[model samples]
Target: MSGERVGAAVTWGLLGAWVVHDLEELATVPGRLRRNVPQLRKRFPQVPERVWRRAETLGAAEFATAVGVMGAIVGTASAAGRLTGGRSGLYQSALTGFGLHGVMHMAQAAAVRGYTPGSVTSPLVVLPFTLWARGRLRKAGVLRPPRPRDAVAGTAAAAAATVASHVVARRLLGAARRTS
Candidate 1:
């Protein structure tokens, strides 16, 4: 394969692996919150048990929705990247993924029926593993941090895994893409 093709393959491959890991980690976040709920309550005396319980129940739905929304947006961005014939699609798709996620999370929290345990503390609760995963990936020498000129490395990493999964789906059939 040509150098460009190799780059694309590696980029896609790395991104695919990252997406799998990200989804797995995302799946674990609510459970982690459940484990931390008592400590969180102890730390913030004003937070009620009812609030945490509600968040736990709602977390699955919220997370699923967020992932679905982000998946659609990022998929479009990735296709745009491919159609435009530029590698920059990877970066753009990544940015849209995390950016939309952040916005959705904030909106969910501010909107009615937003009472997830980690809603208010998502940054603190989520960032540690997020950081740790990035750090470990960097340590393992698979992915690198975004450059100063490219401020979207972390975001790209976040979307890489999801996009990778889509790529896999796109290979399956048109029907899968539509449903996905």
Candidate 2:
């Protein structure tokens, strides 16, 4: 297979895995909320049902989006680096991906908060899948000799994916809300 095709395959594979994780989280959100209700109420006396619902929706959307965006960024970067045969290309890609994560997450927070997106909670939420992708990349036969640069790239890519997913998911949510 061609290099770009290989990269795309890896990206899609990782994204698919993330979607599965999203589904699992959605299934458990209700129980998680039930368990945390008392604390939620105590912590935020003015909490609303809409907030809980939004959280649930965003959680699922973000996961899928993150996976998609991160996978794309990483695969593209790695492939490009390999094609060009530049030593720092991979590191540069990784750094870019890592930084992108912060951006995506911040955007998600803003979207969730209606423009004021508060402190950093997204990184915490998306970390699992991001980390999982990294692990998978290392083990996969197609993508060999994962480097330190990859770790950085993986992180940034994951963050960017988180943000991208959030934006897409939020738009979908808005459309659904309007129609419903």
Candidate 3:
């Protein structure tokens, strides 16, 4: 790899990758849920009424606000990654969460047996880019081995962050539907 490419494999690249993946979601999520949830509710009447209500009611405005909140977090993590040469806990934690997020997207798609927001890029851009970045970090001798507890913490952190962002967005937008 070129020297410059090697240098950029992790830091700002993390945020860049996230932006690309999230852009797909920003464009598709609200519409996908709106279009699909009704059919899902019809086909699977066992689904809880509240679950259908949330999915059906999610608006683009609230979803975009949540994305913006997450963008800020990822931006801060990227800055820390740059300053620390990818050694920052904040950056690495975000990276771990991001990679796992892609896996969850794939699983989500599989569960539904159809496309969902983020499904298209999860294998194409998200998973591959995350693998490439981890490989680059390992080659540079900076990739810390992840502990099992780290996985748990990362997943919990990701879920918490998602809920917090949506909650913040819901309050900020004053939307009738709770994005969270």
Candidate 4:
């Protein structure tokens, strides 16, 4: 495949992986947290259980939207980089961010010492897919090997996505509630 094709495949694969990850989280994260991580309530006493439940229930769509938006940004950057013969900084950042996200899933499972949401697929799906995508990008000369700075940028992007997901989920949930 050409570079663009490879990049596009990788981009879409990332989205697919994200959807699966979000679905996994939606299925189990909140209930697990409520059952196992009792300290979560104590840490955020202002947030009600219903609110958390609602968020968890809506997490798949919220995360999908967030990942889609982020993917668009990275995809655009990749296209622009190819056209202009420039470095794909945003694409690299995304790769780093997503790779780290997979690692975070593993870490969360480790901390809990059990199966955490997304844990089942993190190693099998997210990590491998991310690594493969990064390899493709590098081979295509779309991006260099990721640097520590890229990882930091990616982490920041992930943080921003979290906030965006919450905002989007709230709006979606609110609209649904109003309609009902």
Q: Which of candidates 1 and 2 reaches a greater TM-score?
A: 1
The TM-scores, one per candidate, come to: 0.40, 0.37, 0.86, 0.69
Ranking by TM-score: 3, 4, 1, 2
Clashes of each: 2, 10, 0, 0
Give the winner by TM-score. Answer: 3
Task: Compose the digit string of candidate 1's lDDT tens values, residues 115-155.
Answer: 44334433442333334433433443443345654445545
Q: What lDDT is reached at residue 160 by model 3?
A: 86
RMSD values, in order shown: 11.5, 10.3, 4.2, 5.1
Worst 10 residues of 1 by lDDT: 1-10
- The list of candidate 2 runs beyond 4 A from truth reads 1-16, 30-144
- The reply for model 3, stretches above 4 Å from the true place, is 1-6, 42-48, 175-180
Worst 10 residues of 2 by lDDT: 1-10
What TM-score number comes out for model 4? 0.69
- Model 3 lDDT per residue over 48-116, tens place: 999899888899999999999999988998898888777778887888898899999999889889888
Candidate 4 lDDT over residue span 119-170, tens digit each:
8888988899788877776676665765777778889887786677567656
lDDT of 2 by residue, 93-158 (tens): 453354344456567446445322212433543344345444444454333454776656666555
Ranking by lDDT: 3, 4, 2, 1
Alpha-carbon deviation at 61 in model 4, angstroms = 8.3
